[model samples]
Target chain A: MLKIKNLFLKKDNFILGKISFEIEKNSYCVILGKTGSGKTMLLESIAGIQNPEGNLYFDGKDISNISPNKRDFGFVYQDFALFPNMSVEKNIKFSARYKKIEDEKNLFLDLIEFLQIKDILKRDIKYLSGGEKQRVAIARAIYSRPKLLLLDEPLSAVDPTFRNSIMKSLKEIVQRYNTTIIHVTHNFREASYLADKIAVMLDGQILQIGDAKDVLNSPSSIEVAKFLGFKNIFSTKILGFEQKNKFFSIDPNKIDFLKEKCLDDYCFECKIEKIMGITDHYKIFATVKDTQSFFAKIPKQIFMELKLNEGDKSYIFINKKDVVFI
Target chain B: MKDKSFLIVFLFLGSIIVLFLMVPIMNLFYSVGVNNIFETLQDKETYESIFLTLKSSFFAVLFVCFTGIPLAYLIARYNFWGKSILESLLDIPVMVPHTAAGIALLISFNHGYIGDFLSFIGLEFIDTTIGIISAMMFLSAPFLINGAKEGFKKVDIKYEHVAQTLGASKLSVFLSISLPNAKNDILNGALMMWSRGLGEFGAVVIIAYHPMVAPVLIYDKFNNFGLKFSAPVAASMILVSICLFLSIRYINNKV
Candidate 1:
């Protein structure tokens, strides 16, 4: 297990404000946040690149004081950070010159083959394309067979079409090597698809961390909810609730359209304000009594069957349990 | 029509400056007969003077590799009090008059406690090869230092961070990553510094006029035997400079 306790790093105007978290052995934990949210800073601190104040323990050993080389963690930077002065093969084998590898030969062959980088091993780093560079960087990082691998925005540079394959390769690497990965990115899809545990960060603080579905389905604060793109977040008073300083969030996909007003506790009549077709689904923007607006994601088949139009009145139903009060 | 006239004026002015630079050097080569050039090349004194200039300048550059590169890297990577003042001070060597610089170096190392300490260690810079090297290094060091500083600054720190995380020591990262990435600039700087050292006259004349470097030898020939005698040696030095510079640049580019 990798544990971080009250890690604080202050550099000029930016501060990684008192972060604390833990990842179980071999788990893929992702730190999800927007730009300048201290995600990369937090990862660098964990990698021992920055001298962050607090305790960092890996496998019950205090590693806070250790140098980055002695800490034995592998890092893959967002820009690939491949040694442009060396060929791809030399870059992958760079760590071998410094530290001993238990199964060097087999690991090298496996990484090259698995990452589909066998042919580009002799080429210079500047010659590779974006996707190729990404693979080469990953192969280089995991070639050392580190116990902990820290990746910063690995998929950000990759094209959308290649992300799934890269994501799959990352997952397979985790399973193969049992390397605990702490991947940092802002994309929710990446976090949702690849993360076993997700830590939602905002303003240099981790607002929520839990299982991928739990954090995505129910955010802990308004900041995290907005960052996670929760559509139906509103003041509870708009829904006739007397709770002060409280807001509720309902998932757009969970709310449904009804033909008539149902007897559900959270049922209300709303006018269809706008219907936006998004790939395979349509987004329904509805306003309850022309005051409380909510967005619902309807499947294409359901949207076609309902034949909903703009300014049309319809009853929308929300399950009481789906309303997350924050 | 305005753009056309502007282009014509620019091209005409550019050609005039190019010719201004090229004409004197070309005329010197043209005036020196092939027989005179061959005679100067075969002259033992001229050959030794040129050799001394090349050797001393090269040693100066080698010494800078040890002293200047680390200082440049430190200045590039870190920020501390008086850093701006230190950077400005580094450029002072270039801005000062070379003869005055030689006088300063002479005084600091010749008459003071520094001279006593050096003399106690059986070392002296007066009219010695050490004097020649000191003069060259004092005047030409800014080229290499500034080049290295800018080169190191251009290299992203991410490379070093990634290397450390990959289990390489800080020294290893600097040697394998930082140094190699910044090499072109550093090499360019060294070349410029060596070139500047090869042509140095004022400082070298002040410190070591007896053991004549090529520039001092040319000056001596001009003063004693007029332009007719010095022209062959000067032309020879220029030829050597051009050949060496072109060859090194070609090799650096190929690598």
Candidate 2:
């Protein structure tokens, strides 16, 4: 369990926080933000690598002023900072040399085997590929069986094809070790897939923090909604809702072409302006009476069956349950 | 056509300097008779001077390693007041004329308060092995310190951060991570310092002229005798120096 309260960090002109958040024990917490949003800075502050001006509690122990080495946390850098002077095996065993790790040999073996880095155990770090380096770095970090693990863009350097498998392995590592994880990434897909809790960070503050599903389904503000890729956000007055000074957003995938109105469906007429083909779906951009525009992500199969074309008149339907008021 | 002409001109200019460096050393070999070179090698005084040069330079490098490494690490890792000024100050010895550097060393360690203190403690630099080592250390220390500083600079701070998070103490991380990562540069610096110390003349000559290092002995030979007598010693020193330098470099590269 980790609690960061009013954590403040300043490096030159860049300041991060007044940040307050808590992660449940053994839960995966993802800090999601764009580049230069102080995501890494916050992670470093939590790791005690950067001196921060607030209280940090781990398992109810105030560890704000503890040295990084004494925090018993493992950090995986974005660049997979493996020791260049050591072989993969030696790197994995490095923490064992300094700490009194029980079952050190078994932990080392399990990590290398689980991370699939056993083959390169004798190879120098310089000869490894980026993906291989990442695996080794992970193996080295997990070998110590640390209580908490901080990952900075762990899969950014891996090939896209291997990312899913690596993510699965990371989750499995957390589960098996019972290690609380704080993963920092800009990719919403990664956060949606891996996080139990999500913290949306912008500039130097946490804009929203909650259960991943809650944050995903109902963003707290327009900024958070836009960041989560909500495509249909409009003032309630434009949509004719009774609510004033309120904005509502609907997930693109939830909006559909209407045939007949259902009891809970909100229906409106729009003309298709443009249709763009994505990987496995079509994104239909439509304008409501040539005023407010919105895009809907329609499944390729459904779009093919409907046989819709640009500039065609269509009815857009959204269920009341899908509308999120912000 | 113009590029080709410019290339030719550059090559011509480069070759002149290359030849300038090579010709004199080659002439030393050519002018010295083989028997004289063998005789110089066999001579007790000549070999002793060469041995003294090697020993003094080795000790100088040892001293630099102990004192300069921590300073280099500080300069590389931290930003504090007068950091740039401190870095510039380290290079002053290289810029100062060797004779002036010799005078400065003499005034500081042999004739000044430090000298008096050292003498009171039953240690004196004048005309002693310690004097030779002090002179060598004074002139060659900058090379090692600067080299090590640049080396430490090149090591990514992320590695150290990660090492610390892996439960390595500050000292452990430095010893296992920082120092080993900067090994090549430190080695190169030591070699440069040692090589520089081997050829030091002006400072060592002023400090200790009796227990002659190779350079001082060569100067003494050339001054007291003629070119004919000194050529063999110079040739012998050069051959040994080249052989030692090349062998160490080869070993360093292989490792």
Number of the predicted model whose lDDT against the real structure is largest:
1
In candidate 1, stretches whose alpha carbon ends up further than 4 angstroms from where it belongs are: A238-242, A253-261, A269-286, A289-291, A297-315, B1-11
lDDT (10s digit) by residue, model 1, range B5-84 = 99999999999999999999999988997778878989999999999999999999999999999999999999999999
Scoring model 2 with DockQ, what do you get? 0.82
Q: How well is candidate 1 docked (DockQ)?
A: 0.89
Question: Per-residue alpha-carbon lDDT of model 2 for B46-155, expressed as tens digits?
Answer: 99999999999999999999999989999999999999999999999888888888888789887768889999998888899998999899999999999999899999
TM match of model 1 to true structure: 0.94
C-alpha positional error of residue A224 in candidate 2 after TM-score superposition, expressed in Å: 1.5
Provide per-model DockQ scores. Answer: 0.89, 0.82
Q: Write the per-residue lDDT of candidate 2 for residues A117-159, one digit (tens) a residue.
A: 8789899999999899999998888887789999999999989
Q: After aligning candidate 1 to the native by TM-score, how far in Å is the CA of A222 from where it should be?
A: 1.2
Best by TM-score: 1
Model 1: per-residue Cα lDDT over A1-326, one tens digit each: 89899999999999886988889988899999999999999989999999999999999999999999998889999999989899999999999999888799999998888999999889988899999999998888898888999999999999889999999999877889879899999998889989999999988999999999899877888898899987788888866799887899888888889889898668889999998999999998999877888889999999899989999989998888888887
